[model samples]
Target: MPRTSEPWRKPPKAWKHEPGRPAPGRTHEQTDRRHPIGTRAHEGLRQASQGTRTLRTGPPHPMSTPFETLTALRDEWQALQPLSAENEARLWKKLRLWWNYHSNHIEGNTLTYGETELLLLHDRTTGNHSHREYLEMKAHDVGIEHARTLAADKSRLLTEGDIRDLNKIILKEPFWKAAETADGQPTRKEIIPGQYKTTPNNVRLPQGDIFFFASVEDTPPRMAELAAWMRRELDSPTLHPVAFAAKLHHDFVRIHPFDDGNGRVARLLVNYVLLRSGYLPLIVRTEDKANYLTALRLADAGEIGALVEYFQSLAAQSLEWGIKAARGESIEEPSDVEKEVQIFVRGQKSGDPGPPPRTPTQVRELILHGVEPFFRILDQKLATLSPLFAETGKPDIASVAQKIGLLLRSTAASPDYRWEKRFDFFGYTGKADAPFDFSTTIQVAFEPADYRICCDGNVLKSLRYDEMLTKEQSEHLAASILKAAFER
Candidate 1:
């Protein structure tokens, strides 16, 4: 019989080593199945693809709806951004491998945060993988590096060094090179040559370039002018820090100073500004790209309010997600809130009272008529629970309403209610409107129990009228309200 070597057989005692560490010359074999080099890049591409898919599809679900898949991937992306550099590197390695395995499959390739990060790191540094893998590895590396810096210090205070460090980390890798003409003017290449003579619209920079994007001669002068104006705007005491940062982000991107990577760099810069000014980082997921870009474009054309509103919404969404993730709650959505909102709004316009009003005034009326009695009951229950609001010397209605309004407004603006129109509606109208309508179809349109607070399409809080008011005092208040309404 021909001599046969068993490839599966271990090479005697010499090949084995300590159980924990890898063999001397060999790096640890990934139990996670990620490629060694293209890890981070793979994850970046996977996340980008997933985000695109989610926006195209609906929300997350068990059956792996495209939106669900994308949202899952995005959550992973957000989680990984704040890890230590070493941990991030390790995670990217595994993430890359995980991405590769799932690259061809729509159903089977799912990766958690840890797996995606490791794969991304492994695939990028090793360079042992295919070119496609290499590209993905590079992209993910850039993305994660940026994300890691964003998460470095959650207190939202950064020093000059921190800002410089961010700039270095984000701009260190060269993504693309500048093309110049005889007068030192930058040249834009047709990405598709004769078939497409126009500049690549959304091209990102490659690895290791002096600037994040290509800079034309005129671009610098224009940027200087814009920067000067921006400085003035930033110095204005009237501008809120959050609003300033959001506007700056839009203005910088509109300048498009670099040939590529303008959007990414501008966003990163915005995070730096926000963090330095005591605000959280904003991750504009690829799924939100359309709205994000549209808001920026609108601002570029002098629609500052729209952009500020968008940023405020984004900030609220991000914070709520951060809080939920911190609390270890599931961040995925089971229903398509965007679609639901659209449907609900359409119903209202079509004279359907099954859905609450869409406009702010209308929503206010609904809250006053349908939701305030419930809130009053809740207030009574809270007083009974803690003896705070029911204290004999408690302030009068104007004082109490003012106090309640202030408290609820602050909480309403938190991440929990920022993206949640329903909560916002209730919070704004419950205290502001007295003797609210409890009979109008629009007032009692949707059951309170049916509504939930969502952050980036994920539910963060849910409550029923009774759940918020469980005490005897609350029960009595509720009963009285109902009794009076019926009597009328």
Candidate 2:
């Protein structure tokens, strides 16, 4: 066939950049027939496709937000600086357990704490959780790990893509879920992982009012706005991490960007803000579901402080535990102690032997791991009395593990295995008024079956191998020591 003159140089008829033209491949008739939208509507679609519109970003934080109180806790947690390797492992491990348990729990997950522990920690699964719920919990845990990794990378800036990716990660694969339509008809909605919603969604309030999130057409621009705001604020952080986290979570939730997993991704984003800023994640425990929802409801009604304060309390509590972990104290919540014990008992009954107990072979490793954190916890307790004294010193720790030669003792393992751990805090309290120097020592000696806890050559109590020194005991011990130091 004969080609047209300079055929390569001439653009296609469709590619002509003429005003009032149809799209590249479409004829005017076809374009007009397919897109009956008017000029204004077409422009709206174009803007929606671009999603470049920035939202009106709000203040970084509520004006009434208090900083001095939160910062003191934050600073102390930070000052601890580079926690011991063992404590760091323990702290993160415990946090991981709680984070997984509670995040799912507030969403009406039926898995008990023990069940969640086994699934996440031991590579085992139990309980009557539906296959979907089980998979979701696992996927959410993976999302948390991914978020931690992402937050640790100081170089990457926040982006809408990351949030969508998180929604995909936690939601795992796309599937249909039961949802109500805009007209309140029950139906299954197709969820495309990592994709924005194609339909509008809303909630029915307790008082029968219809509450709404961002419209389907508005999600993209609003999400883009949130991501942009996050990036800019990270560069110049004016708000406290807690406040920032609250805002990030609330904003993401308001947009409801993804069809499914928006709530999970929102919480993930909150922790992302916290982790990047050297703070612990604020866990909304299952028990606090009512309060959490109430706070968010109030926030939706223009009372931002309610949500901010709710988060501030959680952040403050989180900081206290972080400091505790940094100082070698147990970060286990009160419920954690009971949960740990119950799980242990369940394991024993089932002969599973959960989380390897201190064995004879691993005695040194156990002692090294156990004593350092114990000393750190005890040191903080003693450190408080320093202001009343003239000078103070860092606590000293020592441990020796060997069978003690007892004159009369009978046991199945013939004295089995034993270890001694000691912590010493020494200082002078009275420079002129008292002019006295004192050394206070606490020791825990572990045998095969039980452990003896002592202070200054006196046995305080002997607890079974499973028991931990409770906070009550520690507080009483501190008070008694302070009293004796002054009286003596």
lDDT per model vs. reference:
0.38, 0.64
Sum up the clashes in candidate 1.
Answer: 52
Per residue, candidate 2 scores C-alpha lDDT tens digits across 1-488 of: 34332121222123233434676797653353222222222232223222322111244333222445766777788889898999888888877887887798767676667778888888777544589888888999999999999999988877878888898898898788899976778999888989998988777875699878889998887677667767855654534566567667776788788787777788888889878877788787654554677678766655544666677777778888888888877777665776688677767666554333434434444344444455556666667767756666653454332232221123335454433343333455545654556676566665554555566765544444344455544544444544445445
lDDT of 2: 0.64
Which stretches of model 2 miss by more than 4 angstroms? 1-65, 351-488
User: How do all models score by TM-score?
Assistant: 0.34, 0.59
User: In candidate 2, which residue pairs get closer than 3 Å at backbone N, Cα or C atoms, i.e. clash?
Assistant: 389-429
Cα error, residue 240 of model 1, in Å, equals 2.2
Identify the candidate with maximal TM-score. Answer: 2
How large is the C-alpha RMSD of every model relative to the true structure?
A: 24.2, 19.6
- Estimate, for each residue in 1-488, the C-alpha lDDT of model 1 and write its tens digit: 22212111112122234433544576543311121112222222233233431211112222122323323434454554564555444333333333232221111222322223334533312112344344433453464455446546544433333333433443344344455543446764422101111232333323433322224444454455545544443332224444456656665554455443444545656655555443445555432333555565455455454555565555555445444544445443322232234333433444323323133333343344334544555335334322211122211222323343444445543322221112111111323345232221111222222333222343322322212212332243344333322333
lDDT of 1 at 408: 44
